[model samples]
Target chain A: MTAATASAARADDPLAIDVHGLVKSFDGKVVVDDFSLAIPEGKIFGFLGPNGSGKTTTLRMLCGLLTPDSGEGTCLGLDLRDEAPLIKRQTGYMTQKFSLYEDLTIKENLDFVARLYEMDRRTERVEESLKHLGLYARRDQQTGTLSGGWKQRLALAACTLHEPRLLLLDEPTAGVDPNARREFWDEIHALAETGITVLVSTHYMDEAERCHEIVYLAYGKLLAKGTIANIIDNTALYTWRANGKNADRLASKLRGCDGVEMAVAFGADLHVSGTDEAALEAAIAPYRHEEGIEWFRHKPTLEDVFIHLTAGSKDNFS
Target chain B: MKRPFSITRLSAMLLKEFNHMRRDRTTMGMMVVIPLMQLILFGFAINTDPKALPTAIYSADTSEYTRDFTAALVNTGYFHIVKETRSQEHLDEMLTRGQVQFAIFIPENFTRRLIKGERPQILVEADATDPVATGSAISALNAIKPRVMTRDLKGITMANPPAPPAFDVVVHRRYNPENITQYNIVPGLMGVVLTMTLVMITGLAVTRERERGTMENLLAMPVRPMEVMLGKILPYVLVGYIQATIILMAAAFLFRVPVEGSLTMLSGATILFMIANLGVGFTFSTVAQNQLQAVQMTFFFFLPSVLLSGFMFPFRGMPVWAQAIGEILPLTHFLRIARGILLKGSHFADIQADLLALVAFVIVSTGIAMARYRQTLD
Candidate 1:
């Protein structure tokens, strides 16, 4: 399709990224295979996957940092292939690694990016970004000397300084602390409220829960995609929360039992889950009468569903 | 208790380092390739006492005596007469263009003066820009008079065989009359210094970005390939100029090397040569995966440029195949232009061919670098 027509079709959809059949491979190994998704504008979309599950690859393709082997799509209402430069102009991408110049100071890095985008009042924009990211005091410090959390904050500030319509973050909070991650999510929500679409990939379950919608990928294939409650409700897995003294120790005993797909310990409680309701009941029936133990039926959590989904998918390398 | 030096631990470290070394194929290949290249280049290609030096003859007299004299000089295996020009201007043009190293000028009354024992003069003008190149050939010419006249005077009726001939061989070392080596070397060093710095500094530019993980971010931005290339090279142009200025100052004051030609023209030509080297470095950066590979590639290019660019040795001294290879190097052309302008007081028109060569190198190298630069990670 022509770039204009492809873009025209998505104009009415209010989708920032509307790509389909996106396939990318490196050295004969398919990193992102037959991937397709449409993210509406101003939505916080989370991508959860194991390592090397094509999360970064898909994020790169969405932001025009990489081209798919055989795909026809549009990013920011522009053709992914022909109008990548246009897409890149309007989209902000924060890489999985800290990709800014380490030798440059925080202010210099921001000013460089600002000048690249040819923003008016570059010094003001750099100052505002530094102040907003709480990096004003450290503006003169080299980026290489910053802590991981501060570096992540600076990277985010640099990416959003131009106020791009869409932001594609690849594992943005991978090595960050919990407090910094929370602050980052708060900023993400604040940006979303200002009508910025964000597509972020992460391995954190809590982060996945914060997204308006999430997609679980495994081995270059999408396993499940929906809102947190929707995905949990869609799964047939029944979970029984067992709480007692030493209830977590019963995880190994309950594992490998008939119809018990996963029996994982969550701190002091044991969550036994399975797809078949009758078989799952029979396996947990013997534990129901255990001394001082209380077994109660509960809804499956997002982590439970993720583990179950990943367990079902075959490991490509192995 | 753990021992301080355990064989198992040492073996494990060795195995890990071996694995790391094996994984980087470029470094491993460079290790083997650099040594082999140096052996071939330094061993077989380099020749200090250059043979078969290109000679141009401007003889007013083509008599049997001149023929025998020319034959005797050629028999020395030092001078190879490539062109016999009638006009003195044509002979001068050949020397200025570096087409010929030696010019043999025989006077009009050479045969008659010799027959009358009038001590006729045979002027031999050698391009002494490179003193080492002409040193041996000119010394060889001193022995040629006896050999030629012994044959030519045999047919003549001379009562006594004069210990010395009735002829004079006046050797004129043009451009550099003193035959000072520093005069040639100092100017050539400017070209070599600029080449080494410009190529290496710009060569590491893109590779540093890639190695530091910043290339992904740079590519993801709205910048164009040409923008990146120009941005990376422009600052280095100023750096190259500073380096050129320092070298030129040192050559003039420290070594007392004469800047006979226009300093303005030298500055202009040095800029073009710097851009050419920067272009070559940019091309190398695009091909290299990491900074180490980039450095190795720079050294690989630098080795041939220094050895074959007539910087250390004479241009006319090497064989035809080696000269052909040297002709392709930008430094080879720059060395000639630099020496010609600084020492010979040559004008822009004189070094036009070498100037055009540097421009061509810049264009081709920049084109290759732009083509090879990746705008996307794919």
Candidate 2:
């Protein structure tokens, strides 16, 4: 249980986390239902979902911090049901909010965590954590005075200081700037290189693509999950872009039209999608022939998949 | 128009404060109700007039004279005959069991001795469990003594002697001779008020950050729960100590309250109770999700601590079930220990149980707070 013994990764061991048929409910409402996945060791797995799609709950359940309603899992080679405490000891959770000791200096905050873990040479551990996080220069500064980016860095430093094998980040870069988000992702990738498995939930599409793999959840149900190309290739829908005056108005009118599965505004253009390419073309032929408008065949983006999937999905919790 | 300073900016700041106040109805209610509550607590419940004395009568003779005396004592309303025994053997049992506060025994030659111009001794025993109540009993006896013995034989003085105030009344002020209410409350309020303000003020301090999205960095740190709990509570403990000392000094100098006991013991008790109270604050912080809710929760705890804890009311007078509830409050035992140390000069052994209770409270509260805080960390 010493830090030296705990610091090493258990990579040669079986899956860092493995769960199947994970179901979770709150107040008789199912939040995460029939979820199953296996996260390989030393990979940054990204969880992408529209808000309130049970992403956070699924992550919580997978980490052994929460028990599923009817599913079973193992985290860090220990049965989650019987060894949650042990699993928690080795898992680091970086919450979306800045949840550090504001009144305490950055160095003092790290020292406190080091002491909590009962680590030997707390000062050395704190120094090492700060240096690893590139926060040594601002070590003595009060954590409250730090910006969002620095706060994110400090949070990562603290969780990793105890050298947890797994890190669960709940929208860690939520309000962080693009540069800081990139830096955070870089640190996450670096942690992964050391064989620390990282599971991150995010709202940004760019961040999603940065992960080794992506799992998309809508209304507590996984819609499409794989590499960006694979997910796009699996969908049978074809998209056509329309550029014109009041294309936003056209998108509304195309919804409920035959063969037009989804019509969504993409900036100054409207991207129309349908599983039946002929019917889709036929439905948009009249609108395309109108004045002051031009149409072109377009490739489907992740945004198109998200809008199409979520529009058709029922609000299960509501 | 360009030259004018921005009154709108100052007004916006003031408006922001108003909006905050409007959003937090709990604070608004506290502001409106606290003054009225303080008035009732200090003015009404805190009183020196201890009434309802329980007593026992052991009439061994069962003569007409003994019966009359027993009837007179019962009719006075000051004594409620809690136990009536046929023999003196049960008198000790009654007092020890706390079934009756005092016992009076009229011996065999009661009427016969009085006819021989000899003073008959009417025995009286008082249970001195509570000194304040015992003092009132002794004072009441003192006031009634002359009337009992003289019997108002107007314009009739004996040629030999003016009936030399026929009988004497002996009173024992068991614990406190000069019964002063401040001697008890001043030291206790030092603990109670310091506890009320410090625990509640710091209880929500960290929770506020957590709610406002600032706690992420806190959890990210290398700090442990105990460190965070201590760091948050220690500054407030020091503040409580300083406030307690100031209050105690004020009570002594301004109120002229005497600390008949050891000041060191009182201070020790105060600090111990203050730390226990901080543990309570930690519990509140762990349970409450926001600063407003934390304040509400702390006050919810504080109201009962004031009412049932005997800091404002006498614990002895309450029903046993009610007293059991009071015993659960830290302030109750704290007041008992502080009053015993400050007013009665009781040694450490006398207050060991109170100290143990406070220590247990601190341990349980700290454990609960840590466990709950960890569960909700994410």
Candidate 3:
């Protein structure tokens, strides 16, 4: 399915990443299967998937860190295959792991990155980046000695020192504290507002809710893509909430019943959802009259829709 | 109630180690292949008693007695006549250039002097640069006198009854007249030391980046393959030069090994040899997966170099196939060049062929390394 057409937001905006049928394999095992996307400029695009769902592979191909086995695409208006070096020069890619030299100081790491791009006014830019990340006092500290949050900030500063047109972040906020993650997102949003397009992959549901749009992948396939509300609405799933004493206990019993695709506990309540409305209502009919229990119709959440989509897809490895 | 070491835990650790060994196939292959290679090399290739050393004849007198004397020298199985020249300069040139191990010069009237029992002195000049190569060959030279003394002349009869020596064998051991082993070893040590350190050091260069997970970051940058290779290799080349200089200084001052040839020429040859070895190290780094494997590859190359390159044994003593393998190693050629300059005082013309071989090695190894250097993480 073409995920670009599914999203109606900013339909007329120019695309920063326009890829089609981006298939990639390792040792004949397809890691990404016929993936395609068209993300507009200056948008915070979230890539959502489970483990081994081709999110990292797709991000690597977009940033020219890896070549697709067979694909045709343009990243920042340049051919990905023929103009990789050009794409690399204009693209800022933050790898999943911290890839900067650990032996170098924070300021030195930034300076080295600036040198690699052959950027002008290197010392001034490196100083500004060190100050921007709040690492000015510790600019001479070794990168290996930084905390997880500081390392992530330093990596972001290093990749963006050249002022790239596009930024590809692979789980940029992973292993970071909630406060630091919020600050990181703030910086990302700040960058996006300045007309830099961002494509970030993450597993945090709250992080997913912050994106202007999201694309969900499973089994190397694009299962859904759109705004969070659009995806939740498109799922057409019916949900009911049961809030009372021991409402969480009913979840295990409701699960595996016909028409009950998911029965998950949220604190003192149970959220039961399914795509078939009538069968779902019928499945919970017998529990509605229970003593000391209250039931109410509910709106399906973004996490509920993702869980439903994941259950419908087959695991290719199995 | 835990025991100091449980049998089950010990067995589990043993099994885990065995599994790791099985997974690392290169280490396992080396464990088996290196011993077998050493056995074949030591058992079949090495010969302490070298024979058939190339000899040239410069006979001013061509009589039946001189012909008999040359035949006697060949029959000792230590000398093989490779050339026959008339000029005295050509005979000395062959010995200096190491083309012939021994030069036999017979003065005029050798037959008449021997018949009159005048005890003619027949000079035999041997290149004693590698004393081991000429040790048994010189011993075989002594046996020729007794064997030829008993041989009867076809037409001429001895005036005196062979009581005095018919002809005296004047064995002149050249280059290293006293056969000082240090003279051969100290110069060749320059080549051996550079090979040991330079190859292993640069071999770890790229592999360290890869093992540390920095190569991916390096590849994502705009740097080209040649740029990365040279950046990694050039610094180590300077280190090699420093090492060569130290060894040369020690040889001159401590060992008293004469630097007969021009220092500029030797330095030029040393630079070429160092680049060739660094090229080899860089190529090995590209092929190996990690630092351990890179070091193993260096050992595999260095062992053959030390053994077959005539550092520990005579180069000519090895079998034909082993010599062919040694010929491919840069250390073998560099040894010849170093000894040629420091010991024999050979000029550029004498060592040009070895220099050309070193040039070819530098080109081919560097070309292969550059070709194998991955531009992308693919």
DockQ scores for all the models shown? 0.23, 0.10, 0.15
Error of 1 at B24 (Å): 27
* Candidate 3 lDDT, B1-378, residue by residue in tens: 212233332332233223334444674454344433433343345555577989999999988788888988989888999999999999999999989999999999987887776778899999988887898888778767756755654245644545644566666669988555567777777787778777877788678778887777667666566656666666656666766776677678866878898889999999999999989999999999999999999999999999999988889999999999999999999999999999888899999999999999999999999899876666
The true-versus-predicted C-alpha distance at residue A259 of model 3, in Å, is 1.3
lDDT (Cα, tens digit) per residue for candidate 3, span A43-135: 999999888999988988887778899979999999989888788878888888888877667876777677667677988998988888889
Error of 1 at A247 (Å): 3.1
Output the lDDT of residue A131, model 2: 84
Query: DockQ: which is higher, 2 or 3?
Result: 3
DockQ of 2: 0.10
TM-score of each: 0.75, 0.67, 0.75
| Of candidates 2 and 1, the better by TM-score | 1
Off by over 4 Å in 3: A1-4, A8-11, A315-318, B1-173
RMSD of each: 15.0, 14.3, 14.7
Highest DockQ against the true fold, candidate: 1
Pick the lDDT winner: 3
Q: Please give, for every candidate in the order listed, the TM-score of chain B alone compared with the true chain B.
A: 0.59, 0.60, 0.59
Give the CA lDDT, 0 to 100, for residue B208 in model 2: 75
